[model samples]
Target: MRRLTLLVLLATAAPAHALDLTATVLANKTAYIPPQCYTRTEDAQGAVHNPCQTCHTLPRSPNFVSDPDLQQDYAIPGPALENPWTNLFVDRRAAVAATDAEEIRDWVRADNYLGADGRPVLAARLDRLPPEWDANGDGAWAGYRPDASFAFDDAGFDHGPDGRMTGWRAFAYVPLPGTFWPTNGSADDVLIRLPEAYRQTSDGSENLAVYKANLAITEALINRADVVIEPMDEGRLGVDLDRDGSLGTATRVVFAFAPLEGVTMHWAGRAGTLGPKVAPLAAGLYPLGTEFLHSVRYLDPRPEGVTMAPRMKELRYMKKTSWQSYAELEEGALAEKKEDADFPDRPKQFFGSAEAGIPNGMGWRLQGFIEDAAGDLRPQSFEETVFCMGCHGSIGTTDDSTFAFPRKISGPGAFRDGWYHWTQKGLAGTPDLVRADGQGDYAHYLRTNHAGDEFRSNTEVISAWLAQGDLTPEKAVALQADIAPLITPSPERAIALDAAYRMIVREQSFVKGRDATIAPQDETVWRRVEQDAPTGIAEPADPWFYRLKR
Candidate 1:
């Protein structure tokens, strides 16, 4: 009865935008900081009572600066090309008041925070965090980590008897929404610059050439900061929130770059290979096969019964070892081997081996790719891992360590949307291209509605849905039938709606009994085969490239 009253008071006292602190209670607070190791008090029952303050004596004040070692060094004030803005709070000060300090310590105990090493950033360290590190201005830090106290199932990805996905659920990302990443195998708009070695005409030249051309446009937009990466899992798969299906299965990220100076995107001369279509956006005519800055690919285990959202108790993090790449996607086996020791750091343009063990944490590695002139995709130089790190390495952007969410507007507004607006207003006179002062259409929405927690994603919405136990396949099919009538008739709307339904129906039976497949490999596999074993195949390159060779 006493506990219930305290909980009620805590709930009511919490700000509407504040995170639900129910999970803040320490089940075994002494386990986190051993009583013998710190100061303690003995009760009449002879039990020792140790408070959190014993080891958490480091005080974070308003003037403290975050240590460089604790943060990723990526582009600050990230690219903001779209969205509605809001007037969210921005506090980077260290906790001085006893109440603030105690509340922050609770975040550490709940596995709801993290630092550069993937462990929960100790409460003492919260004050040193940069505002970007705690973008949502919440008292506790961001980065929903999975520690021993928050253990999860690691039997996934159909590994051999000795293999287990020990770190599959430790998901994290860089919270840079301005620079967006697109879902894998979806419509790509960001492109890259191809090195001379890949542009030559030879046995495997056609696809490379096509990718080169496609990347030209991507390069143009990236340099101009005009790309916009949208989310793929919004209001889909029998769920109203984004990332409901995405956080559990499959690895996809989209980054949309918005340029300060309007961009002029268009297809290359060989647009026929990309399907003979032209689409324009903002101020550019986009041809087929356009690409983005880089891609972060991982061998996802696609585990069953795992779900996440903001402020949920059963949160998980994506482990670093499961990460892989493309564009700059090096070859498998060999690339993986090379990357094992030199993860997030490898020789550029070299293909080598990968890691083969349960990683200590998440590396957020990705296989990047770009399109060719003939509208074909090509693997990036082997060193493409750095391309992804260049932007995502920012301090405190740890939710998947990539700057993308499964869908936009999953909750009131996703993380930092409000902060972005506030920052825009704060820097109204700055000449910065990426962080230009302006307002998006959703700024008003951001001001009025908010997800209420910084460490939130689409997973929060799904958690509520799952709590109701209405996620069965039969229910999914029924919901699909129910939604069919409500779906509008427009082609664009219908396509999105249909995609969502299709994904939900397909994923309903992920773990019922089947071998899990690896995520899609980069296009370089074919290039290697064509280059090495040309005689075994009738064509050495894509049909378009083969014709070009003729």
Candidate 2:
């Protein structure tokens, strides 16, 4: 019995429960459009590329204000423009998103070009986590790669099941020659979007590419996900369910994450002019980096001694309600930016400040980290960080954003690396704050105007053909950029975006473990054939796929 006792004591216990990483497909309160292509060209590129200010000529440009359906092809995907060989004009454009444009593109450069080498040059992206994520109460979180998978599903993401890949086409960031929507899926020629000219629209009006591609923004990286089509409904889109979705709604996407920390922040309120004060922050209030009336620990909660000034007030943080609802959030966020002390250097240096209290040894590392991370994402795009960080709102459901973050996940063994979960310390769940509009002036936060040049309309330019997004690129045509119309943006595109979102989510969510093995649903829908694309592409399968009867 003594020996048995000794063995029991010495015997290692079975691994404690695995961290419950239930990567549920949650919706963001705000949605954004990824500025389609990620490239760096001077703001002047628009002129050189189009020479007519035609790319930005909205409502219409080439011929003047035009309708999306006027052409057969849709918008161009980012891939086509990455190469100057194919997109010769892209090289002449000036570098506006120079730093970020290069960083984001370089970070995933391998994904751009194909090589004879066996290794695939692509970002093996994990699940989508919030950016600006802060754990350990550090007032900041860094980015890391996660191990996750994405899949395209039919149940939730089938837009047009077994539909012929005839009329669908991929447009170029380059200009296209003619319209081709109902014909073969070929639109490499009609029109293009200026990705470099992307200005953070205050009203969410310009987030076209992000919203369209379901990438939140052009700078966002595609993780392990496969796109598919699905039935669309009003409920999924927060529309009046009673109303008929007369609009041919597209599919809802389903995404699965290995559940890494994405854009997350943990701020403890510190409200005090001089002395400590405890107070509640109002909902929908954002903490201006200014001395607020509350003591809120944003990254870490020092609940023991943390408090605002004698008259300290709570720091209220608002988050985007849904990605589709980003319009509202952007309005709010943009308004807020207009009110703040336009501190350009703040985003990169905020957390490392002495007030933020970096632990002794971690200070240097923290500073260096801020330098590197800020340079990578926020240095040129504070609003992007704010826009991203805001949505991945507070950890758990606490009245005050300050609460104890669970220390471990799985076990000490699991956390050997950075695999810790915020749930182990306590319950409300880990920080998953949402983005709020008016968080920062879009361009000011990013400081992309390093050249001291006019930053208005700094975005990438697409060839006119991509505007249609149909037909084969080889057979695609290019039109002059000046002729298109200034698009007022109708509900049709919005509805299509919602449909695309549905398709991306449902497809990914249903096939959680497949990894990035599956291609995008749109890819399947159009059978996007590009000279740059790989050959012998296999046809994708649909879950509820129907075999049409003759």
TM-score of each predicted structure versus truth: 0.19, 0.20
Deviation from native of the Cα of residue 47 in model 2, angstroms: 9.2
- lDDT agreement with native, every candidate: 0.22, 0.20
How many backbone clashes does every candidate have? 94, 191
The TM-score obtained by model 2 is 0.20
Models, CA RMSD each: 26.9, 26.5
Tell me the lDDT of candidate 1.
0.22
Q: In model 2, how large is the Cα lDDT of residue 365? A: 12
Per-residue error for 277 in candidate 1, Å, reads: 49
Clashes counted in candidate 1 amount to: 94
Error of 1 at 221 (Å): 34
